[model samples]
Target: DAARQARYSFLWESAERMSCNRLATGHHRDDQAETVLMRLLCGSTLLGLGGIRPVDDSGRLIRPLLELSRKELEAFARCNHIPYAEDSSNLSEKYLRNRLRHKLIPEIERKYDPAFTRNLILLGEEAAFFRQCLEDRFRQLRDSLVEWAEGDSPRINCPAAAELPLVLRRYLLRRIVFDYTAGGVILSGRVLDAVDRLLVRGTSGRRLDLPGGLVACREFDFLSIGEKKSAPTGAQPEQIEIKGPGKTTIILGGLRWELSFEVRPYEAGTNNVFFQKEGAEGVWEERFDRDKLKFPLYAGAWRAGERIQPFGLEGTKKLKKLFLEKRIPCSMRMRIPVLRDSRGEVLWVCGVARSALGALSPESTSVLLVRALCLPVRGFTGVTIIDT
Candidate 1:
């Protein structure tokens, strides 16, 4: 009903009719701060700590008063002799925000500094700036360390991300899985920590179901984040030819990805890493002598009718069956990427597995290191992968 009302209101007041992009509202900082405090008390997610969004997704419904205080607004109204309707119902104790405003805030101002409201407003502004800086840092780290697959999900190289500073890691992790539910059931701190641990250290095939139907999965050395996907959507996973030993690019959902390769000594087993999205703990450099690696590693989307000897599983299994067993549906199966070598042997399946054949061993003369990178796109689209 609210959505329907909003839609009607938008259509009635649309730019075509009113010459305005949106109908703006005045929601003061006290209102926003009250919201944050209430949500925190009620157990909102980490991202909720920042309070309401300044700009909503649709580019309309902007909060122009995010930086204003009720007192200042009232003062402005008085100074300008701006007549406005005052709801006497505001004195009612039925609403918490109203109660806080009428009862608590005034008392706080008297008991504390006379400039309490002004100071709080300034504090909120400063906090917003700090949040921007944190978000900026997180984006910078995300650009270098994380990859969004075809869907609006995120993939992080556990080992590489773990090496980042704790703050950036947490911010990235929280932002990747952020939900805009102000009054819905949210994931608990325990579940978030469990997901983090699963990414940073747990074995592959582990999964966590968060609120809003979101799912977190641990595969190979990357953490996959997204809605509970059903089947692989696009072209079936197929063998793609990589001209070996050089960078390559692939495009999905308007995002470009790059794949690069190098040679070095190999480890006995998977250097399978899961780094938390917080704190600089996962960053590290492993190397192999250049002479030890095989040339011309292959990389591309997983094709239909492909199979893999998934980690500990016995014998070979169809990739489709594996995804089914893992509860991955058809939609997601479409986007899972696959990497291979010249002989058509699969090497790495994005967020899934690195073939035993490609597993680095101590005796390996050269190690083939594949680096996956995502090229930038215009806006907030979902995840995409590229390997070079």
Candidate 2:
């Protein structure tokens, strides 16, 4: 209605009312040329090169003569014997496009060949084609190795992704992290190189915090994407052990800890309660029937391919599976220690599950209690543990 009023005020009162499917404009290739130059000088990114698009989300605006040249449009009007009034105001040098069209561009055409207009159009067509090709390459890169998980960071299998051509690889990595952060930002080239460096070197546990609250963590020998939080920052993995009647403290990944042993009556659910505490959540202690058990039983760090039957479950489960089911984020899974006996039997998955083998029994009389906690590691420098 406002458009109708404006045109009517200018004696275009006889003009048809603007409809959703129909819009009236006189823009032509000259206008396109002006827009290209303007945006090139003022735009922030290269995607702006496509010039005006075919479809406008707002249905009221339409370009009926986008493909028409000024000479062709004038010829069409003459052939149809159409009578249309020209706005006298357009003759003035008030608008930038008008000034470029009337003065600057005409001067360029005069100084050079009069065929500059044709050359500019050809150049624009080439640029548009190049833009499309780049977009297609980016799309292929996106489809190859990108994946998203609910309420979590995107995961790109870095080893597989690293094999892509560097141009596409860099684009895809930026796109993954950008989408991971909801398009809020892009990672610096230095940060992307840092992650690529880790992947190329086969570094499994390396990570870097990127712009826009994004964390690019390496997992499964790949890159896993996630968000940074305000508190309880992401924690790293550690393997610390407590010996029978021995106390020891070690710092891993910036978290602090001390493990000490205490001997007491073996009672069902007694020591289990202590293991559930802060210091004991990752700690494991067990009491075996001395007469029925072997004295050479062992307790220490986990060896690879370890499996254990969790408490209350009859069958054995992979220690790795236990970590996954517990919703332990990828970064902490490797470093969490597993406790096993001398016969390659797992007694507990620290901070996670207690195996059925050494689980407390109702008639148990003697027991060993183990505790794991996050404490301030004293006098130990150069430990960086971030808990996510």
Candidate 3:
């Protein structure tokens, strides 16, 4: 799977580098049948059993030779005196494709049916026709129901999807995963079943780790999909420093949501020593006493064993415990933004908790305001405001 992704990526990149709009491959009629058989053996949906596409979803990958058999291509080359060499890998049985081509397929033809390959092609054609029809409806559903969150992750509307037919519900979900992984991973039946279960019963903020390093999150009536957040194994996790003022955007490694920061005067507010804006809905906001915070504050992934004096709480509480209280999935705890002062004192944990240390006072005085904007796939914006 890795090799195929790399090869296609290389081909796509090479084509782009050459300023080519279309990248064609010689995937012949026999090859299409083999693809169908390969996917069948590996377990696939109606879409996968359709075999190689003449033009893939991106429309950049074109297999012009799909209608012509490999033998026909070879005969044409010989007639034209065009010299061509086959890759040595094509003869190696180490690959499943080659094994099918040289052994399994031949045996099936010898004993079971001579026209087996042709039948497979016909089946693929039928499947492809049905798939195209479904694809049209799927697009309409996606446009109206699926929201594209940060980094192109899809967030689905569960209530809306429940209205679709069962076959289409599964198909839509599967296609989201398939297209997101770029075919690097195909969810097995068991995995697909698990996704269905999650959709029906999973609690909000629940996440199920998926194949190909993607994750499925259930937030209320929405199903959020995004790359599994993970920094490199041993790399120093990226830390973005907000030097008070102006807007700044930082992209953390493997994290899709862009963190934005800004600091400005508190134009209108009740003249109170400490002021904070947060509620059961709307954007997340945190305000702190300007004098309590040090400049050049840093933000990074939450650290293990970190504790915070949660606002309105009696004493410091471990961030882990706080996460549990809020029903934040363990899978996402590590990626929550942990904001620290210049002295390395954690002042706030974005999306989860805020400390009482910088507890804001007067609303008139200027304060640091850091805002985060993440567009959820289901027609919502995740916004966070941090003020001095």
Candidate 4:
């Protein structure tokens, strides 16, 4: 296989160097039949059963003899006195393709069905047509259901995508995976089934590792598919000081952290860290009391033996314990930013909880709202926002 690929590469390079538009090969009907049979034996899908195409749409290669049988081509060559050398490898039974071509195909034609080859050709053509139809349908549905995010991953709207027919769902997911991976990986039937199951029934924060360093993650409302790499790394933990009402961006733990502080009127719907007694009403954002906070506010990565008095909890608990209870992957524990006071006391475990020191109270006149937004790197997406 390596040698074959090298030869093809050489041919393609030679064509390009010569300013040639196409490199033609002598693949015929028999080759197509063998390809179809091999794919079927290997439990291929309809797309795989489509067999060999006559012309590669990329315009780099063509097989003009695909419609002609090998026997006919040999007869024509002999009649025209056009001598050609037979490849010795063609007779070898060591390769699966050679075995099918030299032995199995002939045996089937002799003993069972003389029309087997013709039927295989017809099946390939039908499969190719059906594959094209499926691809077109997939594209139509994809445009409506899949949203390509700014990063390398693409997000599929679970509600709308789940409503698609089962076959279409599978095809659409396959298309998304292929496009994100740039066709470098082909998902197997089992993997596709697993992904479909996740799409249909998986809860938020669920993840599945796919081949070729890719991962499929389920957020609250969408499924994000992209390459899986380790979370970003950073130097030794450093405290980022925040004085007052302002916005600052910090690079820590391999992520871009955007922290904004403001004293805004507490609205019922907005996620405002309130200093007033009302506390937080929204689930997506965290609320902290401005008056209770100690400056300068420091932001750093989680450390060993760190504990936080998570709001509404009985007492202080280990940060590691909280992470375990939440099922946050270990790889992401450090990447989660931890906000602290000047004394190194944990305040708000960003996206996790706020320490008791900063709890909102009715006596407070103004509420300080601190918002932390963590942006993922190139291959990652679905930034988590923790609210307690």
Best by lDDT: 4
Candidate 2, residues 1-388, lDDT tens digits: the string is: 4854786355433334432344556678877777676656564234445565444546645677768888788888999998777778668898666787788779989997697766666656666676677668877766566655435446786777777776556667776776666668886667767767665664555677777677777665457777764554345233443335566665443344555555567655654423333332233334443223333444444444678877766788876676656655555554455555657577665566776665556766766665545453332221122221
RMSD of each: 12.1, 13.4, 8.6, 5.9
Instruction: List the candidates' TM-scores in order.
Output: 0.52, 0.46, 0.55, 0.73
Superior by TM-score: candidate 2 or candidate 4? 4
Better of 2 and 4 by lDDT: 4
How would the candidate models be sorted by lDDT, starting from the highest?
4, 3, 1, 2
Clashes of each: 53, 19, 12, 5
Lowest-lDDT window of 10 residues in candidate 2?
A: 379-388
Candidate with best TM-score: 4
lDDT of 4 by residue, 58-150 (tens): 877889999999999999999999999999988888899999988999999999999999999999999999888889998787878887754
- The list of candidate 3 runs beyond 4 A from truth reads 1-22, 148-153, 178-186, 212-214, 227-388
Cα-based lDDT at residue 156, candidate 4: 88
Off by over 4 Å in 4: 231-239, 243-247, 252-255, 258-292, 300-388
Greater lDDT among 2 and 3 belongs to: 3
Model 1 TM: 0.52
The residue-by-residue lDDT of candidate 3 on 1-388, one tens digit each, is 8988999899989999999999999899999999999988987777778888899878878889999989999999999999998999899899999999999988999999999999999989999998888888898888898877556678788888877787787788888887777777777778877887777777877788888788888876778877876554775567778777555544333333444545556655633233334452223345566656777888887766778887776988887777767766544555456778887777877666677776656543656665543334333334332322
| Better candidate number, 1 or 2, judged by lDDT | 1
Model 2 spans > 4 angstroms off: 1-27, 42-48, 56-64, 74-104, 173-221, 224-227, 233-347, 350-388
